[model samples]
Target: MLPPFTEETARLKVQLAEDAWNSKDPARVALAYAEDSEWRNRDVFLDGRDEIVGFLTGKWERELGYRLLKELWAYTGDRIAVRFEYEYHDTEGQWFRAYGNENWEFDERGLMRRRYAGINELPITADERRVAV
Candidate 1:
C-alpha cells in the first residue's frame, strides 16, 4: 500500500511528484497515477492514463519552456495537498507565473487515483520570471 502516509513519506512523495512534472514527459508523469486515475485540472476533466497523457502533451506543448516547483502542504492516510508555482511562456513569448494547489488521493500501490487542481495565472515579464529548472 502506498498511502497511509507519514511525514517523511509524504514529503518524499511531494518531491517525487515535483520531479516527475519537471521532467516534462507526459508518459513519465502519467505513470505516477493509477490506470483509471481521474483528474480535474482547471476547467478540464480527464480519466485514465491515455487521457492523462494527451492532456499533459497538449499542456506542455502550449505552456512552452515550463518549469515547476511543488511543496507539501498537508497529508493524512491516502490524501495529500500541495501548493505549487510554475513559470511558462506562451507561443507569443508572453510570460506567466502560475500559482496553484492540488489535492491528491492515492491508491494502495501509491499511484494517485484522483487529482484536483485549482490555479491562477498572472502575466509577468521574462525579467520577473522566478521558477528555475
Candidate 2:
C-alpha cells in the first residue's frame, strides 16, 4: 500500500479517496495527504495540510451536494494517475457535472505528497444528475 503499488492496492487507494472526499469533511479528507503536501487543484495552489483543509472547507461550502467518483487510470512506483467526476449544485440551484484528471505522488508512508489536477465543469439539469452521495 505504500508505493510501487500492485493493481489491487492502487484501485483500493482510489476508492478510499473517493469515500473520504464524498464525506465532505475537510479535516477528515486532509488526513490522506502529507503534512507538507503540495497541490495544484484546478488553478489554485496549496501547500501543507492546513491549506488543504482550508481549501476543501471553502470548496464544500460552495459546491453544495458534492458527490464524487474516482477511478484509477494508471499506477507505477509511487505515482498514480486518476480520472474523476463529481456533481454539485450552486446556491442558485444550477447543477454542474465536473470531470477531472489527477496525478498523485505518494510518500513512503502512503500519504500523498503532490497532487495535480485539471478539471472542467458542465452545467446540467437536475434530471441529468448521474451521481449521488
Candidate 3:
C-alpha cells in the first residue's frame, strides 16, 4: 500500500513526481497514475489515464522549455501533499514561473488515484529564470 510513508520515502516520492513531469512525456507520466485516476489541474477536471495524457500533451505543447521542482509538504497514510514551482516559456517566448500545491492519493500498488492542484503564475523576465531545463 506504500502507506504511512516515512520522511525519506515521502521525499523520494516527491522527487519521482518532479522527474516524471520534467520528462514531458505523456505516456511515461501517465504510467504513474492508475487507469482510472482523477485529476484537477488548474481549471481542468480530468478522469482516467487517457484524459491525463491529453491534458499534459496540450500543457507541455503550450508551456515550452518547462522545468519543474517539487518539494514534499506532508504525507499520511496513502496521501501526500507537495509544493512545486516550474518555469516555462509560452509560444511567443514569454517567460513565467508557476507555483502550485498538489494533493495526491495513491492506491494499494502505489499508483496515484487522485491529484488536485492549485496554481498561480507570475510573469518573469528571461534573466529572472533560476531553473534550467
Candidate 4:
C-alpha cells in the first residue's frame, strides 16, 4: 500500500523540484518523473521521460540564462499544486519574467506521473530588474 501524503512529503516535493531546476540538468530533472509521465508545458504536450528531457533541453537552449523559483501552493492526497516565477533571456537578448502555475499528480512511489502547467511572459524593463533568489 502507498504511504499517506503528509505535509512533510509535500514540502519535500517542492524542495526537490526547486533543487532540480537549480541543477539545470534536463536528464537529472527528468528522473523525478515516472517512465511514462505526461506533461502539458505551456502549449506543448509530451509523454515519457525521454521526451520530457528532450523538451527541457530544447527549452533551456532557446531560453538562455534561465533561472526559476517554485513555491508550493497546495497539495492533497497524491496531487500537488505550485506557483512559479522565472526569468530568462532569449537567444536574441530579450528578457522576460514568466509566471506560471503547475498541477502535479504523483504515483505511489512519489514520482510525478502527470503535470499540467500554464505560463505567461511579461517583458521586463531595465529599471524593474530584480535578482532571483
User: How close to the true structure is residue 27 of candidate 4, measured as C-alpha lDDT?
Assistant: 95
Which numbered prediction scores highest in TM-score against the true structure? Answer: 2
* Model 3 misplaced stretches (Cα beyond 4 Å): none
Rank order (by TM-score, best first): 2, 1, 3, 4
Backbone clash count for every predicted candidate, in the order shown? 0, 0, 0, 0
- Candidate 4: residue 2 Cα off by (Å): 7.3
> Which digits, one per residue and each the tens of the lDDT, describe model 4 over residues 1-133?
1225677878788888988987789999999999999999988999999999999898888877788888899888989899998888887788888899999998888888999999998988645557464
Identify the superior model by lDDT, candidate 1 or candidate 3. 1
Local accuracy of candidate 2 as per-residue lDDT tens digits, 1-133: 7998999999999999999999999999999999999999999999999999999999999999999999999999999999999999999999999999999999999999999999999999999999965
Score candidate 4 by TM-score against the native.
0.92
Q: What TM-score number comes out for model 3? A: 0.96
Per-residue lDDT value at 124 in model 2: 100
Candidates' C-alpha lDDT: 0.95, 0.96, 0.93, 0.86
- Candidate 2, residue 90: lDDT: 97
For candidate 2, the per-residue lDDT at 36 reads 97
Per-candidate TM-scores read 0.97, 0.98, 0.96, 0.92
Error in Å for residue 57 of model 4: 0.5
lDDT of 1: 0.95
